[model samples]
Target: MRAFSGSRLAELCLVLLACWLCPGSALAETRVALVVGNGAYTSTAQLPNPSHDAEDVAASLKRSGFEVLQGINLRQAEMQDLTIRFARAASRADVAMFYYSGHAMQYNGVNYLMPIDAMLTDEADLKRFVRVDDIVNDLQQAKNLRILVLDSCRDNPLAETLKRSAGATRAASIGRGLSKVEAPRGTIVSFSTQSGQVAADGTGRNSPYTTAFLKHIEQPHEIGDVFRDISSDVYDSSGKTQLPELSLSIIGKFYLNGQVAMTVAPTAPQAAPQPDPCAAAEAHWKAAESIGNVSAFEDHLARFSSCSFANLAKARIEGLKQKTVLAPAADGARASGTKAFDGNYWDVTLNCPASGKAQGFTRALAATVTNGVFHAEGQNPGGSNRLEIDGQIPADGKTTLSARGTTGASAYTLNNLAPGSPYAFTIDAQFERSRGSGKRNEARACNLVFVKR
Candidate 1:
């Protein structure tokens, strides 16, 4: 090696001292990411772009000096395990990110990300799906910056099934797209489109949002500016139908390209905006209309007595009360002349067989037919599970009964389903005056037997 000049040696020594004082100065700061793309759905139509989007994003992140955990066509259990590992890695990282492109939805205002194998037959299936909030929470543990990107606003194929099973009142809470979420301080949350709107899966190899995102993510600009460019690009390219939206609470500039040093400074948080009264009333009115129940209308009237919907609420209450009175009279008339199935008391037994990854169990219930209508409600003692069965028995004594309930105990459920997940299925049954037998019509194998009590 050639001898260095005095000036050059002194400069090199100073550089070494700086590196010794600040260990990270000599090395790249730690950046970690979790990227997931689900395209091969088992129950719904497969998406065309998610797997490609994930691969492209992962490659870009790796080029940007990020350690990326990438997954494609992930199942529920695999997704959960990967997230747990990613969360652990994020806790040690300076900048952490999560990107997902898949089938996602909002149910009762909560956003859920669906895995490839997810069969979201009802709202209860949400338990098996990942919540967007959970991913945000994971990123929140990162040291400096957190970024969440969701290119999951494609039209959901499972929404109709959930709506049909949830009943009218609950169905209204199932929104068309992912719900709006407020970012925590020092974090940014991005959506492919505005809340309650759908986005197109591009005809190309990636989604429109991902296509725009990849174009600007490595453009040597601040992350905020990059996302703004992405939003604008998506808007212009989609003929103004898709407008990307973001909730950003980042305090200072963050550059993804590593071309600039990250700068974060403490800032006072802004006060939350006060809710608009008329808007709140309108939302309440919508809920009441969806419920179409006397108590729901009465509650709305109590809350907004002078609002514009007050008169409508009162009218609905009156109509509901009249219907209630008429219903009892009609039932009494039918009861006076006992029908074939009327006044029949039955003990109901439900038997579920063991399936893959799920344990089997049995349940018992009591039912009575009144005015040719069968009704039963059952609850597990000291447990959260509850079931309701109801339907009309025609003269032929064969009819389909509806069964819906909140699930309990993961071990007892199919696929080890999360507790409190909602499930609904139909039971095809033929009944005599005192005996009945039925089979559940769904993915699982379950049979019901009824005997006179």
Candidate 2:
């Protein structure tokens, strides 16, 4: 497969832009990628489109100078893990595209990704499973050319779940339009079917959408032309079973054909020993407990020279930085006094680090900090967090907790603390999940943030 090293993506972008000005073709290396497939669900209905779509797409991506991440039958955590990894890969890429084939639903206007083992029996489970905005936004965060392909317009599977839990007339409406906001300068989003519209399954083995996607993706066609062809092909092939949509205001030229861009940063004379960039970055990475801090993560990753947490950390940082969220480093200190947690929740921004396997899966450690007292309790490996303070934390709470290490994944419950504890706080854990979209890493455990009161 054609490869564009992270080191090269920067240099190629400039060339591609210049080539755009000229008429003829410009031979520049474009780092392209394909994230494909999402079949092998346990309880939910299996997705045929992803398995089929991934195959042709990966091959086409290879031809297009793209690296591919593939997964099948992935859980929510696993899907997010792979997606975070892909985001890191996109860091140096000039052109990044994410494609998916899976089951998705909307509830109370919130969109969710249907994981293989998703037990969507109620509305509250949304936190347990996948969030659609999370996936799309993470990809949209990539630094350069961004393209999103959503081949998931299947009929809603959680119709019963929504009706029972949400008391809504329908399961979830596939809302039209992108996030009701314009994306960065260089971005394009393509959907298999229009919002709230269902695509048809094929009479034969392959679904109509996949067949059309495979047909147009490889030809020497502009992105817009390809979409038009796929749209027409789907209508004709599946008895008009599917209708696709595109929400794009991209002003630049995006060619499936090899086109590249490059830029150079002003450099100063070499300075001696810049200190361990990783160590310096800890302050930034550990700053905000919430997810979507892509900038800090990216800054840290670029400076490291093959650290253990390199891949996962990089993905997490980029995921948060790219997403248009407020996952900044914690600025306001937790109020002093005893604080209570209301069960396990996350500050997920990116995928868990591979090192987290060693740190354990728990996101935070339960501790009691009151009146100059500090304690660490509930040190269970991947168990529920049931750490409580001696008294109720003061209402004027100030001071937060910090939990680092990718391996720590904890479930916490903080309650019934001392009545007059001066200070009580929990580390807001930010977990990260890479998109599986029928890609591998679906089985990868999603990072969790434990809370106990």
Candidate 3:
């Protein structure tokens, strides 16, 4: 029987040769990554952990087929250069990832992603140092999956007097100016903490949460599934502390090293970002110029120093100033009666043909008018409120204030509004129950009515 079988050995050898000799049989190589860890804040607390974390994650991403570029403690110019390079890489790569761990702060409302060396002593310092949208939107245009992991929510080290005036309460709740921007399609953005929550930069060699993240990233699973495990792991490790909230509006599932998912986690939802004012200001500037309201155009530019429309605002304002023109004469001043409402000695005088509508004001919360805007002050326990303006708030642009609203708690919402009509706005910011322990309670929101004055 053995001798008979040997007669066909040449045929079997031929078959085996055919199976092993195929070309173009491998999958495309997955190129990905931009890992940034900025831990050297000159003005505030130094984050020793982020640099280590960046180094670690960068190595991990590289091992999995990422054509990695690493930047650490970059001065302003280096940071911008890296961002530009990262964007270029993303456009061609199969997958793009951005990881930043460092100090970040939000002011006037726009969030600034701070490098370790950043010191926000003056509002203008932010313009010189950090380039937020450049980094985010660049990756947005990538051909494949876009993944951003920002552990940049550390305690702002800017001197107390130099802080951005967007009312913040706890170390955890200090706004990092991230909420106003959107992670584009095919992107998954995860913060170390919730949007309004601050994550702990642990006292250990690495931040507790980030250490957990690094641990799970290499595990055999889809990135999203890995994050769920990371989220659970971090929570358990931190003794049931704040858990990470994943906000995703991804077109499809993204894989690590192109390994198709063995596990799928429920993706998070993307919050439609409130409007951007610079986006509006650019249009508004053109509108004002079209209407020949030089004065109006000039005024809008002065307040929004950091808007994406800053240059346009500056140029337009100079033109208007040189022309020395005023708004048309038909818009005469009107005198509406005065109504002053005082809460905690904060008084607002609503005068002149009312500047707009009365009922547009929200009754649910408190309100106050300062610098011609309404805000509900003292609504939260520490009096922090966030008043998002109408229209898209430019990622880095100027905002024209139409009306300001805030509760006593301190979250202020100022609409870079048009003086279309006189607005009669009212805000009642009453304190409600705490949302959770070790966290400030949510303040009430009030609507303001602006009418023609």
Highest-lDDT candidate: 1
lDDT for position 30 in model 2: 46
TM-scores of all models? Answer: 0.55, 0.48, 0.53
Q: lDDT of each model, Cα atoms only? A: 0.79, 0.50, 0.53
Task: State the lDDT of candidate 2 residue by residue for 223-341, as single tens digits.
Answer: 65466567666655654445565444355446676333343654875567666544433234334222224655665566653542344454455444544353222212233322233
In model 1, how many backbone clashes occur? 1
lDDT of 2 at 111: 51
lDDT of 2 at 355: 27
Answer with 2 or 3, whichever has the higher lDDT.
3
lDDT of 3 by residue, 259-314 (tens): 33222323897678787554454445444443444566666666555653344445
| Candidate whose TM-score is highest | 1
Identify the superior model by TM-score, candidate 1 or candidate 3.
1
